[model samples]
Target: MLERIREGSQGPLAMTIVGLIIISFAVTGVGSYLGSSTSEAAAVVNGEDITVQEVEVAYQNQRARMEQQFGEQIASAFANETYLANFKSQVLEQLISEKLVEQKANEMGLRVSDEQIKEAIFDIDAFKIAGQFDNDTFKAILQRQGFTAVSFRDYMRQQMTTEQLSTALTASSFSLEDEVAEVLKLQQQKRDAQTLEVNAADFAGDIELSDEEINDYYQANLSNFDTQEEVKLAYVSLSVEDLMANESVTEEEARQNYQDNIAAYQTIEERRVSHILIEFGDDEAAAESKAEAVLAMVNEADADFATIAAAESADIVSAEEGGDLDYIVKGDWSESFEEAVFGLEKVGDTTGLVKTEFGFHIIKLTDLKPQVTTPFEEVQEELTALLLKDKATDTFFSLQEEIASAAFESPDSLEEVSNISGRPIIQTAFFSSGNYPASVNYPQVENVAFSSELIDDKVNSDILQVNDEKILVVRVAEHKPQRTLALEEVKASITTQLSAEKTQQAALDWTEALKQKLLNGESVYDTLAAKSLEWNEVSGIERFASSLPSEMTKSIFSLAPAAGQDVDVVSLANGNVGLVKLTAVEAVDEIKAEDIEATLQGLANNNSRQSYDSFVAALVDEATIERITR
Candidate 1:
């Protein structure tokens, strides 16, 4: 289901859904029970409320990921009003789509049992240690991700149910072989070309920038130069691990825990056996005769059972291994097979022909292991650690309540909670929206640090849960307001910008003039010779070649001119211009089998995705969705 969500690429809405899946694990009903009224809802899908906080959290998480990927440049990009608005809309739409999917899944009667949820959690690589599920590792990771055992289980159940729905929708998507072949031909076709290029810098020096133009430009876009609001914060945190470090479990406690969970130490008796089978197909009598003969050989003096079984057994899987069936406990095999295997009382014992659904079997018992209990002394260390953790969990929650109460009662400072919880108060350097201090990574921290209440009234923030075992209370220590730069302070920057604009316009103007001259019976070679620019000769180049400029290739391949009128104007990516002339085109009549196979796979995948996308779109259109808040 997660992979299917990520595979969608129709629009920003699809990508937003993928981003939400990456950043969000579980959130209660869209409105988060902030209020009974729909006024606080970010959206309402089929009358189900989506809260403002939910959308904000999703948007903030997406912004954090973008900032991490692109650094300071992403912050600048977010400053654009248009981009920010579009992004928020897309995020809200994604939340609505999620709710729709969940509703559809429920309507379809999709369900995930407790056992399935447990298996899925165990299969997750994040919760595994050394390729197997470890309780300690699983708990620690869930705690770090702000999930309790119950909540994480619920999350996994929801994920599994949704996956069932997704699988059903996309199971029948495919593509035809001929469609794939056609795409391969088009994608592999190559073309040849030659071009004369012009650089924008050549004309930039000729165009001049005026003081009036620079002043007007700077005054018109003042928001571009404004600084973002920033704040400094002081906070105190309580951690469960810190309490566990000083807590210990005595031998008495360990013994009591072991006694309380004594059933976990019990094991069942198991057996190891081998068998030679004569399968009963069309002739049951023949099978019985062969089994009788094998049994006779086993009973004969100096007769090796393994050699006879290997040469005569119809069970090919175990024949090479001397008919070794490894190990078996009760409920591990068929009723008849189980009865026969356990009937033997001692090792090296053989049973007479045993009848089963598969055939007649000559059974030999090789080993037996009786049920046993692990002594308390052998598991004392493990028990002690478990008891200590349980005690720490109890103490941790107790401290959390105490600290929250103290912080709320004394809002002026965190000193009371810090002393009561034994956690020192910490301060962060100044930071702003979309740009946070490395030490402070939580979105709630930034939100509280910059709120009007924190800045204007200077009150302590409400206790915020950073994770399953960590809680924080923050207060603002300093504040900085937004500011805009004056024209005098940004005159040089404006001048540089205006110069680039003039140069681009001048280059476009020059290209237009050259194009008109070519259209009016001017020779391309003669014009380039007069202009003292060399022509780059390219032959048999691909439409998607990296050797030539992307804009040049796009223009050359968009449409071909008549045989004698192949000259066309193209814009280069470096704010320059180009005069491209198509020379020749080549067609590939055949492709390698491997290439065709790869192309076919890609086409099938894309077609399946398109079908799935259409299904989702149709679901959305039929649903009643309303924007209650923006």
Candidate 2:
């Protein structure tokens, strides 16, 4: 149901309620425009190529975006081959549509000037440093993402072209008064309904069955009762947990591991500071003397640090506001300067003049964050477990290779492999291909158990890695060939099934009669009361009301405003039927001002969406297109 709501948001009204509607106007050339060129095309639109590399890159980018946005809940679906193929196909189609749109834009003489692209790039916040655009930051970001200035500008041009086309299409769709009124009337509409439940199981209780009927049904569907071929496995398992049971790390070892990797246990500590740098001139003593003067000024009782910094600091970028240099980790600055900064004991403490290669400096510590190190005793147990697991992991993998070789050298039994791994041989009961027991159902063990090498050829399997912790080698101990079940075995079950089908059919036939009676304007309540079925009255039902079944709400709303004295046969769960009589239709005679504006916007969006879809469809119809499979 939540999925249904998410899908419903794609419609005209949902996005408009939030005041924006997005149209897919991706310029497919962004992939190729960013610099990875392909000679082979996945699809060709008119004279232009939609390259194979482009589709693959787009597939990756889109897959990553979705996985990040939705997180782990839906991540596994991408591993499905069919889902990924269909996903790629949709991307290819979008690329084809984009190609057609690009051609149309060119034919329409749409143009984007270089100055426009420049302005767009400047306006982007990602290219800015200290609230203003920086050329180095812009170039570095583009270079990291594999875009040259020329190519990025070309990509921007393509984006602007598509956006211009979209704007033109949007402007052509204007909402008329009647359109808004008609939409508002339906959106605010309500209905009242009379409902009756006709249960199949109620009808089923009175139905009769006979020996002849059961026999006929059984013979007709005998193939449905065929028994699956199954196998029993003789296997040896290897696991980190089993190995850990025998593995241990001594106190000394845990302590040594802690000391060896202590760097990882320490968090970086730094100080936020504001410093006044005074550069040395021809006379080095004068610079030192000058620094002394500045220090004295900052030490005065009534000094404002920011006011002094703006007036006197030499680092102009930071000086515009204050002498702030942000946070500096230990290794980031000159040794003397860093020592002076870290030496200050608390906030607002000043470090006396310290000389560096660049100049002399007076520093104020505004904030200090001390280094935090986890105590050795605090993590002793954790380190022991980690060390045990590491050793067990190594032993498990080593045992895996030894057993794989052992099973292959012996080729017929589990005794040799089991001895090498120090685990007892396990036997699983007969299970069909996919239904192995928890102990033996490790990854490919299922298919390996049923494989001809184990079943017919009778050889041991190579070691299968179920996961990081578990591994298994399987050989079939027994094989049960497929067979059809005898008639006596399924006869009673078939009888129950056939009886239920006949009862449900009988109920359906009775519903048709009930529907005809209602259509003929017969008294609904009296007819229902005669059958001992209650007719319930419900009022003021909305279209998407969760109180009622979605199907019932849909049925109630299907009735037109003038649809009076109506009766319709609707389906219910477990093969029942709902006979609905929609009695009244209520629509808002007046709406709030905000809702009226929302309805108007919704109508305009609907028009734009319809026009965009039609325009794209028309372009697709007129194009010459060819698709190439990956």
Candidate 3:
């Protein structure tokens, strides 16, 4: 029962908590500047100080996650002043909300034990190796994400507590019968529609825009023609590959490593076992007596063991497959089951009735695989490669600091760093600050290159970690200021834009006239059909039907009248005008059981989300939050 409860709703709560802790957005990494601020407090929530360093760390962590998820191009877009301000505001709000939630949890006497936190952490797939939690992997991941053991454990505790609060809140918000009925009514209601599609391309040929119109559009939207500021960077990057090119592992070192970790190469013994279970339901005596009888039958020399097991075994899943459980290593099964299977020495050996929590099992040892290890000579190459990589990683880190220090000391050029670190000075072509060179795909390089300090002071930017194995040190070679393109230079582009705008307007005008005509009980279907603009009759489509196009469905379902009701002209995403008319509307009285369940579940989820949002909103309104920094 405890296991069932623990596994209930699976790991969504933990995932949700993690998402809250590290909310991803472009507004991240801007907090890095706050790390050095004299004012420690970034914000104060109910007299509690939210430190600048905390915001910086959160920003950096979330930025790294965003960079990884969306790559440098998308991440770089968020580096602008406006986006950063918005991002910081969002981050602060999230932090405040988290504090409020944590305070609420404390007030409610919610307590998450160390054991529970450990269990939650261990359950995370990211920290798992071979299906079990790995301590080293956990530490490594935390380190990569800029977290310490103490901080991460506290984070987990807070997350778990908040999750408990959330679970309670969601569970408390029950699905109302009326709400479900309304949802069912909406879902079940069907509309028959006739659609007329007007292609924008058809009207484009008829659109002729005057130069006055084009000039007006271009003049009004001058910002669109303005080019972004660009920079050319000269930098030197250090990677494990750079070290690996020169690094080599001696035979002696490889042999020593092989000897030290020999167990890693050795295969563990495995057993293939089949079993027949007789569960003790109401009558334990009857179950035990049946298991004993099955064991006796299996012990017979000519007994069809699989046939008997399939016919009589209470474990339905295994029974259907003739009770054949494939090869399993040690620690893969329950203790009693493992003990019973491992105790049987020879193939075809059957165990007597062995009782466990589930039931009594008549176990048969079907097969066994002996432990084996590959010869040292066969794995010598593999071991050498591994050792070389490890050596390269160590060398890369040691030299990374040296290169960064050298680059910073001589920011005007990478020549000094190249000479000091024995790395080549690489220069990039002039690229817009936001649109970086495809080859130099590091986010840190872009951040440093575009930084005001680097551009104005012309100082060597900080040595930035590109990834675990890569480090970059960059200096700006040339900076190009933002500029606006002249009217004549963008005249061709302006003409095309104006033409498309005029065409789209014409299409909308034509669509509106047709819609009005349809509302007045006029049949233009014959006229449209003559021009191959035939009206497609869509019938009995529900709100969420995939058969009809989404735009059509939206336009059709929005109608209230049973007879022809002209819907608003839909300007489709594909630059086509869609005019729709409701031909018929049908109301469904009897909803299917599955439909009801799905609708109710959706309503319950939506209600729970709203409740959580409202709860957070209420907390914020009650708490006195003060911004300490702009």
lDDT per residue, candidate 3, 410-463, as tens digits?
Answer: 667778777766778788999885677865765566556778998899888777
lDDT of 1: 0.76
Off by over 4 Å in 3: 1-172, 248-379, 390-412, 415-439, 456-462, 523-526, 529-532, 546-549, 562-568, 627-630
For model 3, which pairs clash? none
**Per-residue C-alpha lDDT of model 2 across residues 434-536, encoded as one tens digit per residue:** 5768776444565467778888988889987666688888888889999998878888788778877877777777777888877776766675676689878
Task: List the pairs of residues colliding in candidate 2.
Answer: none
Report the candidate with higher lDDT, 1 versus 3: 3
Judging by TM-score against the true structure, name the best candidate: 2
| Residue-level error in angstroms, candidate 3, position 408 | 5.3
lDDT of 2 at 193: 87
TM-score list, all predictions: 0.52, 0.71, 0.59
Candidate 2 residues lying further than 4 Å off, grouped into runs, are 1-33, 36-39, 66-94, 167-177, 180-242, 266-275, 279-312, 317-327, 335-374, 403-498, 508-530, 533-565, 568-572, 576-588, 592-621
Point out the worst 10-residue segment of candidate 2 by lDDT. 18-27
* Ranking 1 against 3 by TM-score, winner: 3
User: Arrange candidates by TM-score, highest first: which order?
Assistant: 2, 3, 1
